[model samples]
Target chain A: MTATDDRADAPAASIEDRALALLARTRRWHWAEAAFWLGAAASFALLPDSHLLLTEIAILGLFALSLDLILGYAGVVSLGHGAFFGLGAYVAGLTSIHLTAEPLTGLLLAGVAAGLLGALTAPLLLRRATDLTRLMVTLGVAMLLYEAANRMAWLTGGADGLQGVMIDPILGRFEFDLMGRTGYAYSLVVLFVLFLFARRVVTSPFGMSLRAIRGNSLRAATVGVPVGRRIIAIYTMAAVYAGIAGALLTQTTMFVSLDVVAFHRSADVLLVLVLGGIGYLYGGLVGALVFKLLQDGLSAITPQYWQFWIGLILVVLVLIGRDRVPALWRRAVRRGGAGA
Target chain B: MLTILIDGIAYGMLLFVLSVGLSVTMGLMNFVNLAHGAFALVGGYVTALLMNRAGVPFLATLPFAFLIPAALGAVLERTIYKPLYSRSHLDQVLFSIGLVFMTVAATDFLVGSEQQLIQLPTWLQGRFDLGGVAVGRYRLFLIVICALLVVGLQYVLSRTRFGSRLRAAVDDQRVARGLGIDVGTIFAVTFAVGSGLAGLGGALGVELLGMEPTFPLRFMVYFLIVVTIGGTDSLTGPFLAALIIGVADVAGKYYVPQVGAFLIYALMIVILVLRPQGLLARGR
Candidate 1:
């Protein structure tokens, strides 16, 4: 490592200087990333009929991104992230009904609500516990929320779901239409802005510390990384991101339901993050696109039994291997390099 | 109140039977299996199919329910689940969930989405007044059968050579293997037996829990709750945990119908917060 680094940079460079340079290198945008976003923007005109689907994908992507922040980077495994997402959706819906039709304000309020809940629950997760305990706790919390929503029929509309969640359009100009053109644009903009922020967070030193903590919390703690505090901060931040995504869902559809807080929502987001490849910000977006498209195609084929096919896919994917994917990708790349 | 307690004990016993296998696999193999309920579903359906179609008596069909799922579990463990033992918890969870989805959908397609009915014999039907507390004959039968099964299981696990080997393995795989124990064979047998027990529980629970295509998805959380609360170390923990959950659920539903599982979920979270290892985790 020192030999290669000496040729590329100055031999006298300090370890800290070399580390800063490496961090800077990771922060730079790749050509593929620029093209990815460009393609997403182009979809507005190219796939005009699919805006509704695109909007769903965007919201799902953001939700998956929130999960990735904790699971991938912070090494926290959650089976009930839908709690925050649902909380955000319900809060946003209620805010719209009782307070304001302004979209962004509702989004902010929803985020704050979710964030506060996250802060309250974050300590519960910070305790020394096994993955099983964490999974059960998170799932239990979500189930409690689901029960609350079900019992509070008057407020949350019970099983019937919240309705009449009307919203004013972006800056009171562009309205959410039947075609979902405005909704798609709004969602995409939010996704892109959030994605940029996530990208920055992951590339920074804070992100490095998170990765360190994930690798070995004990070692990171010994190295003075403030492991618990960092985990709480990231977890809370991820909750806010999820909340915003849920709020976006409520705003776009103008509805919120018990399904938002359901176990399946959490499971689906985890699936999306895993499918895209964790630890990377764009994994969520790519995964969301693939999962959404797959759902659309499969449901069209057999609406009643589409889940069977998805199950088959998951089984096959795991059997074929998942953790080995990066190694396989590298091997293919190396072979291409050899051929070149 | 006594009736509720009796009913809760019956329900809890059924839960212990259903989830004990999950506890075995999860505790011994350290695999996060979300599809454990699928085994129970298969057992329940086996009973439902035989009783409804083949003129087979409900009592006679119980053996087939146990054997069939046990055989299926043995084969699947050998073929599909063997490699996953060493995989990460996430992979295990995904694999099991996939299995669950496939099972649920397949059941839905084969049998209509409607709930399956198991025809109980005249002997197992109706309520019997036992000392002033009116008890359903079926519930009483369930309690007796489940209690016997639990006793039988406790005896097998505590007294037998196989049980000792299994315990050694759960302590440390490497050390157990070094001592020349056939951990693989033990695990396969345990897995099959666990699955068989789950099936039996499912078959017995047909009158209570109701057999449906979405059975696995509906009851996954309950099974998990039992396992997590009970801890995987001993049968006693899970047995007691299942009883607590069953009683809490029955009483909660009976008295505060409006709460609808809120109490149970809250209880699980609280227990986990206080004892993250479980109700009866051994000190390391």
Candidate 2:
């Protein structure tokens, strides 16, 4: 048949029609988004008594999300993100102790300090491509900070850390209670606001540029993206977020320890991101929840075996196919449908 | 002043022993094994346990100390590291970190959290007078052993077939593979050897620095700084970097006690900024 005749006879759609159809088919993602938010809100509301745990999860979730910005979006692997976190916490603690004792002011100071530090360090740290070099540079930075903190005992309180930090109420209303009721609410609010901001940044044109850079920096640079500038900006943003999270932690606990910048804290943040799945914004929050829950539950059950079990979990996660969760969930849904 | 220099040299030697293996693996395989320090800790702990608990002679325990960490490294490579080699650096990092946690936790469970001291044998215990300066015999022996290892490793890499293969693999894995060399075997063998060296360093250096459960985290930064500043792919870089860092660290601790703690990191930053490729580029 002639081409025109064939086209007339065949009930085929145009490219635009196909595109529209595909968009319609994928619109159900909106419902999935709604379900996720609803579940999160419900969980938050229902677990009112779990303020301590929830607050911790909130702060850590924010910290992990900050890491996700650089690692997941910008392709910078750091083992020293905790430096900013610890710096923020210490700044907040010192501010509260020696300055105004206001939580909001402390957090703002923390974020600004951390952001400046990240900006300053980015030029040198962003010069490397190999992950090993990046790891060492970041670790060295963190260790340097740790040593400075220890040596500057008069200012940082050394190994004792900045203790007895008393934070006043936010806006002179929400006092931090011993039960962590106020702390949980404050952290949750801060986390949600930051999440919203992060979501905006990630979905923005700038964030798309970051994703492009992450996928292939050489190609992105060839395509006219200023790779260095994007990296520095994203790195600074991540550091600021980490700082806020750290401030939240110190303000909530009313104490700041050198542990904030410790190696284990860095490792823990990495673990949470991995457990939650990198590259997804929700991954950090989910990973934090699961990790905190596991840590809390396992520690209660067997304090000594807590790390052992966590290590086992990490090992199993690594070995049993890192992408098994989505695959298994899909399979389970199919199986349920078939059974029904 | 003389004593500080002597102490710095001895400390530098110990650092060289711990960092050289890490430098080789980092240079050759491009593997970031965070568990490298864990092996060192294992070596120290095993040596200490044998000597302190089992009543084994200090000299006799050396073989066991080296062998135990070597076997551990081999087993770890087979089970955990092998799968991670081809994965992304992030995956490898996470997996190695898990390995570190498991090793540390297991060690803590098996042994207590208390620090264990390594008492040198009588012959290695006393101090020797050198030019009116009395230096510890153990430190002198450590310095000598470390020097020998460096010299021997340089020779092996320069002259031997295995070393040649390793150098080839490090320089260009794809080309080495094209040449029909078993890249996987080379990687495994290199990792084992690297870990064994870490263990040896740990056991030998225990007299200078006691072993503890927190040893991995405590010294991981030191080794990393050396490797980073010296450049990862150069064997001689870590050696030279270690000496600089060792001297700087000891002198900083002694003279400028205020900023002494952060001297190494400062040195690292300065070196990295000045020579980003490290002090030594990998030899062709």
C-alpha lDDT score of every prediction, in listed order: 0.89, 0.82
Highest-TM-score candidate: 1
Q: Alpha carbon lDDT of residue A244, candidate 1?
A: 95
- First chain TM-score, candidate 2: 0.87
Model 1's interface RMSD: 1.1
The DockQ of predicted model 1 stands at: 0.74
How far in Å is the alpha carbon of B208 misplaced in model 1?
Answer: 0.2
lDDT of 2 at A84: 94
TM-score for each of the candidates: 0.96, 0.91
- What pairs collide in candidate 2? B27-B233
User: What are the clash counts of all predictions, listed in order?
Assistant: 0, 1
Local distance difference test, candidate 2 = 0.82
* Tens-digit lDDT string for candidate 2 (A1-340): 0233345444678744554454454332444455556766675678878889988998999999999999988999998999999999999999998899988899999999999999998887666566766776787788888888888899988888887799898899988898788898889889888988888787666886898888899999998999999999999999999999999999999888778878888889988987787886776887898899999999999798678777778777877766665355446546766775
For candidate 1, lDDT tens digit of each residue in A34-110? 86899999999999999999999999999999999999899898988999999999999999999999999999999
- Candidate 2 at A146: error in angstroms? 1.3
